[model samples]
Target: MSVAIPIFKPVSQMQLTPGSTVTIPDVTWEEFESILQELGEKRASRIAYNQGNLEIMVPLPEHEISKDLISDIVKILLKAKGIKYQPFGSTTFKKQGTAGVEADACFYIQNYQQMIGKRRLQPDDPPPDLAIETDVTSKTTLGAYEAIGVPELWIFDSGKLAIYLLKDGKYIKSEQSPYFEDIAITQIIPDTVERSWQVGSFQALEEFANLYLSIIE
Candidate 1:
C-alpha cells in the first residue's frame, strides 16, 4: 500500500511598506522559521515571533536613522568610558518552543567576551546585556524580550527614550540605563536625534561624542 504525504500550500510573501507591521496568527515555529528563511536576511531584518503569532515590520528612514545614531552614541560612550562591549545589530535572538525577537540593536557590555567565538547563541547561554528598540512606527512590547530574559532594554519613541530594567521576570520602566547608571538617555538622545537632521548622522555622532566628553571631563 502507498501512503500519501500532505503538502502544505506555499506561503506568499506578504507585501510590506515602510513603517508598517503585519501579524500572522496561528503560525508554528517551523512555519515561522520557513518564513524567515524565505524572506532572507535583507527582508526579514525586523521580524518577530511570539508563541503562535509572527509580526514582520518594515522600518522607515526615520526609524533607521534614529536607531543607527543612537547606537553610535552608545558605542562612543562605551569607548570613552573604556567599557568592553560588542554590538549585535538586528540579530535574531530566539529560544525554541517560546519566543524570538530581532532587536534594532543589541549589545554585550559586561559580558562581551562570552560571545566572542560563538556563531549562534542558545537559550542556555548568556543573553545580551542590552537590547534597543527604535520605535518610530511600531511599538515593541516587552513580552518578546522578557521571554529571552534580556536584562535591560532601551526603547526610543516619539522623541523620548525610555529605559526598562528587567526585574522579577518583568520589565519596569526606569529613568536611566541599568548598565550605564549615570547616563540619562532621555536627556541626551532626543536632542541628538533632532540635531542629526540639521548636521547629518556622522556629524551628529561627532557632536554627541564631544558633548559626552565635556560632561565626564
Candidate 2:
C-alpha cells in the first residue's frame, strides 16, 4: 500500500491584496506546521489557527502604521513608568495539538526577566503579558489568544482601541488594562495614534511622551 499526500498550492500563487484574508478549513495540526514551514519567518503575512481552521492575512499600510504607533506608545509608557519589557514583534506562538497565532506585536512585562536572553518560546514558558492586533485588514478572532492564555489583548480598529483581559480561562472586555490601570489607556492611545496620522509619528509620539511625563510628575 502507498500513502497518499495532500497537495497544496504554492504560496507565491496566492494573490492576496493588502487588507485581504484567506481561510482554509479542516487543516490538520501537522499540515498547519507544514504550512508554517512553507511560509517561513521572513514573510509579511500574519496567521491564526483555531481548532482546524487556518487564516492568513496580509495587512494594509494603515494597519502597519497603527501597529507601529501603538507599539511605540507602549514602549514610551513602559519607559516612563520605569518598567522593564521585552518586545516580540510578530513572533509565531504555538501550542502542540491546539492553537497558534502571530501577534502584530507582543510584550513580556511582568515576565520580562524570564524572557531575557531567550530566543524561542518553550512550551512551559509563560505567554506574552500583552498582545496587540490591528484590524485594518480583518477582525481578530479571540479563539487562538484565548487558547494560548494570553493575559491581555488589544485590538485597534476604526480609530478605537478595545482591551480584553483573560479571566478564569476566558476573555472579558475591560476599560482599563491591568498593567496601566492608572491611566485611561483606551482613550489616550487611540487619540494619540490617530493624531500620528495627522502630525507624523515622531511629533505625535514626542507629544504623547511629554504629556505622560507631565501626568506622572
Instruction: Identify the candidate with maximal TM-score.
Output: 2
lDDT of 2 by residue, 1-217 (tens): 9999999687646889988899988989999998899889988888998898889999999899989999998988888788899998888888787899999999999899999999887889888999999883333358888888999999998988999999997889999988787899999989898899899999999999888867855
Q: Show model 1 residue runs off by greater than 4 Å.
A: 1-12, 136-141
Clashes of each: 0, 0
Number of clashing pairs, model 1? 0
lDDT of each: 0.80, 0.88
Which segments of model 2 are wrong by more than 4 Å?
1-8, 136-140
In the predicted model 1, the residue pairs found to clash are none
